[model samples]
Target: MSPTLQNEALQSRAEALGQSLPPLLAEAEMLAATLMLGEHGRRRAGSGDEFWQYRAAHQGDPARAIDWRRSARSDGHFIREREWQAAQSVTLWVDPAKSMAFSGGRERPPKGDRARLLALALAVLLLRGGERVGLAGLAQPRSGRSQIVRLAARLAGEPEAGDYGAPETAGMVGHGRAVFVSDFLGPIEPVEAALSRAADRGVRGALCQILDPAEEEFPFDGRVIFESMSGSMRHETQQAGELRSRYLARLAERKDRLSELARAVGWQFSTFHTGAPAQSALLWLYRALEGGR
Candidate 1:
């Protein structure tokens, strides 16, 4: 998109998302730009199929890696050949369940909206990068611009109200990279199990855990009412100071468990609370991935 259109797009997005969107979009854009420059995926270098310069050979270099045609035209000393394939396919999975729509901490957008903007922003990056990007709910097909528009419309219309594991994922398998976005407020173990399932199937992926800062720190200062996004759980809070330490411990456990599960399943996991400007986490991750982190 033109820089003007891009800014307008982001502004439109932020407006739709209430107030907590600018930071999220900024983060996602930074991530998108960094991801394109990263080594993990085939990047679009101007023309869709134009050849780019090569790097030095590395260990276990495959015979296919050698560009014989190029070598025939130059001093052939390297055996490791890196061909720029078409832009790598990227599939983004977003959880639209009501739980993901939870909103807190000084009128932040609901988690669902944040996740949508996040996904859309990434889609903008991917599409702009000439990558064939698809957007899917838990179990949906490879989406196109129309599908993404539908997703955006869904966000604009209902905001939230959906199931987490819709069994649609069984049919979709991204050959390259899959990005999973969710709040993960539900029983965390099941989500890990799902990730494990994906890993066993050879699906390389990353997870961006979108969270409301309220979940990280029990910010309730007085008699506060707490409700679950799932609509089946609720807790009345009259005292947070007494529970702060315990809550912090549990939160720490949650973080550790998420990290462990991600490591165990071979997926990169990141946690982002609502209070943070999304750009930092997204850029940090983009830089890490670019650096092969």
Candidate 2:
């Protein structure tokens, strides 16, 4: 093809990619705005010049550590603590497996859409608070408003060909934080391996499980044909309702196993349904990450 043709083709592709971004970005910004409305950014304790809070002096308190003015106003000695001003790097992984595209109905967004929105919204909050955010194994951690565009583009990239998605652990920085958002209907072994590897690298984070309401409530009754989102696995059942007990049991077991895995790795885990408001998950994620640090 000629140079002009090549440039035109590239421009066309770029425009097509840009088209998918605004809705996700706008919705994410709106969702993030609701949380940012009446709240100040997260604050935690560490070594810094700015004062965080005052607490009673501990057993090993030195004379110099006590705040004379604050102590005089109080019954006991108080030590001034400073807020942690150092910024943190947060890497996020939103599962791109075809499974995440599943939606039980037309009323709500797909699991994949919800996952991306939450990821982007969380990134907006993190960036606003002066932290570096990136997509795990895809984008390196960087802080700036422009990074959100890159993240949204990457999040909208091609989906992996599989019935489920696995967390990507490569290229993770040691002692950094990460967030893995997925339906996690895949084999537990991959999830275990990813978390274990992250733990070895001292990468603590959270697991936000996004699922469709239909998947959670097994509402199918009569004859039903169930197939993986990738169409790689299929099963025909005469009575889908009968399998609800088994399905629910397995789901419970998976949740328990995930919780256990998270605990073992010094991480946190939470579940979000597509049917619920996105703010709840974003808030939990924001707090969970802040607390983890």
Candidate 3:
């Protein structure tokens, strides 16, 4: 197929992915099952084994007098109902902005593509596990698995997010977890600020920094022109060897800074390369957040 046609096909697939399960969706299902093995009280609602506080026996109280054991001990019969907690809510904050589309060296699925895949996978996993999910992108407020297909379709048609990005805060609701999936290529301060805001609101979050393998290895040989993914700037490289050290140092610093930020704020942070299997990355992310302890 033609280049445009190929891209369109990929787009269509990504969108359908939200509602329709992919062949490899089993991996995500595995992760979800692992995360929610014993978790309950949300997806499947039924009379649970939980015993909450007793309430006043209202009119037409059961003859058994709920908490009859306690009533025999005392004098009053009180009705007891299980405290039902809604399912754990998880928000998939995907950086649907255009910047995520960068492919550092050669033609490969861009970082943005992987980001979308991760977000959708996570959402599916959570949904399967009986959790409500929220979505944020260069756009915002993509919520609920019911809307997953449409959200994915919209993201498929979206352009690369800008350097200065927007955030999704309005739709974040209920108590649960938040997962921010992005390369976070723009200004560091804003990204930190956004995370801080989420943290402040008691929204626990994790950050996944996606990168291209070539970006780290400095694979360009002789001469190359490097363009910024956000269309902000470009760099010309005469010899990749000469810039190797600088590139590595920057990479190291970025990793350290991200790790430190996550540590200080109690959010999990992880980095993944494009060539790495994204399913493995999801596992690694869960491990990092779970502390392996």
Candidate 4:
């Protein structure tokens, strides 16, 4: 596509993304709040204004290290220790390829929407916990709510380019975490190569495979015309149900390979279906970051 046309397409997509933000943002916040009520609530250590704990004054302590008021209450002086100031940067990517546009039915949201929603919602949770978040292949990692807003805008506005697969991360630096949200239905070799590259940079992250219920269930019967999203392949079958067993087996094999790849690199892998609540995936994602597994 020409640059001007690409720009226009990006703007149009961004506008469409913007229209969905209010609801998505609200849902994300709600999920975060719900998770916070449980034992897995937001726990982050950073050099922020929040007080972490108080420790006894140690040798070589600066004259100003003592808490005078606390000293007055006890013979020993105490020094307040604030939370760790350093924030970890997390780069996120959601495949926006044509395949992601598939929803299987008119009543369901596209796989791309689910991927984008999970990516943004995870960003919200991370930002709230004082971590830097960025959209992989789109923007640099940044912290605070502003970063979330900027990411949402970018996600909404950018038109997907390139074939369906992993987003390039060659320009990214640091050993911090990364999150890839996608249907992951593409060929395995390229995906493995991309992830291997990221691992070479000391980057460890999670792979979240988001798929439509139909994709998982293969709930079709009678004659069906299966079309490829990239318009490169198509298959017409008189007995669609007959393909279900083989389809599911291939999917299982794909997921198994992906899981093995992640394990070999000491990363994490997860799968989410659109029919389920998004919060479950978001919560799992948050915990994965915490455990680094």
What candidate 2 gets wrong by more than 4 Å, as runs, is 1-12, 37-43, 59-62
How do the residues 1-293 of candidate 1 rate in per-residue lDDT, one tens digit apiece? 89999999888876776644445555545656654544334532333344555655567778776767656767653543233555545556677677776677556866766666667666655555455556544324333455444434443434345444321244435445566778765567567666666677666666778888877777777687677666666788788567888988977887778778777866677888767765655554443322321
Q: Clash pairs of candidate 4? A: 14-156, 14-157, 46-84, 47-84, 47-85
* TM-score against native, each model: 0.68, 0.92, 0.67, 0.78
TM-score of 4: 0.78
Residue 84 accuracy (lDDT) in model 3: 54
lDDT of 4 by residue, 192-280 (tens): 88788888888888889989999999999899998887777889999999999999999999999999998888789989988788788
lDDT of 1: 0.60
- What TM-score number comes out for model 1? 0.68
lDDT of 2 by residue, 1-293 (tens): 99999999889878877898888899999999999634324477686677889988999978998899999996899998888878788899999999999999999999999999999999999888788899988999999899998898888777888878889986677898899999998889999999999999889999999999999999999899999888888999999999999999999999999999999998999889999999999999998887787
What Cα-based lDDT does every candidate model obtain?
0.60, 0.90, 0.64, 0.79
Q: lDDT score, residue 200, model 4?
A: 88
lDDT tens digits, residue span 139-229, model 3? 3434456655544554455554465354455455434567777776566786777667776777766888888887768776678787766
RMSD vs true structure, all candidates? 8.8, 2.3, 8.1, 5.0
**Best first by TM-score, ranked:** 2, 4, 1, 3
Q: So what's the TM-score on candidate 3?
A: 0.67
